[model samples]
Target: MHIHENRPGVLTALNQIFAEQGVNIAAQYLQTSARMGYVVIDIEADGDVAEKALLAMKAIPGTIRARLLY
Candidate 1:
């Protein structure tokens, strides 16, 4: 995930998103400014399902960007 730039409330938005999908975040790091930043979430999810979830995250307006790190 990355900052939406125009949108605010990154953490709250993600927390709600995760709750909605029953995503379990093992670890996470987030830093954002007025423009952009990065979010890394270590999650417990099956491979294929996780990829699909990642795509869904990208589809969210405030997310702007989402990726599953190695």
Candidate 2:
């Protein structure tokens, strides 16, 4: 997944959401520049639940977009 946000609390919020959805983040990668931050998260979840979780992630404040990579 890709998360576009540069502010604090974005990752924490995402973690909370994932926890609520019963998804476990297996791995993650973060890259930040002066203007933005991008996070790629590898999660373990059921297919249906993963879709819902991605949509929830997209709805988070400061998140420009969210999508599954595979």
What's the count of clashing pairs in each model shown?
0, 0
Measured against the true structure, the TM-scores of the candidates, in listed sequence, are: 0.70, 0.88
Clashing pairs in 2: none
Residue-level lDDT of model 2, residues 26-62, one tens digit each, is 9989988766788888888878988888888888888
Question: lDDT, candidate 1, residue 7?
Answer: 57
lDDT of every predicted structure (CA atoms): 0.69, 0.82
Q: Which stretches of candidate 2 lie over 4 Å from their true place?
A: none
How well is each residue in 2-70 modelled by candidate 1, as lDDT tens digits?
445545666666666667778888888877676766777778878876777776677666656677776
Which 10 consecutive residues of model 1 have the lowest summed lDDT? 1-10
Reference-based TM-score, model 1: 0.70
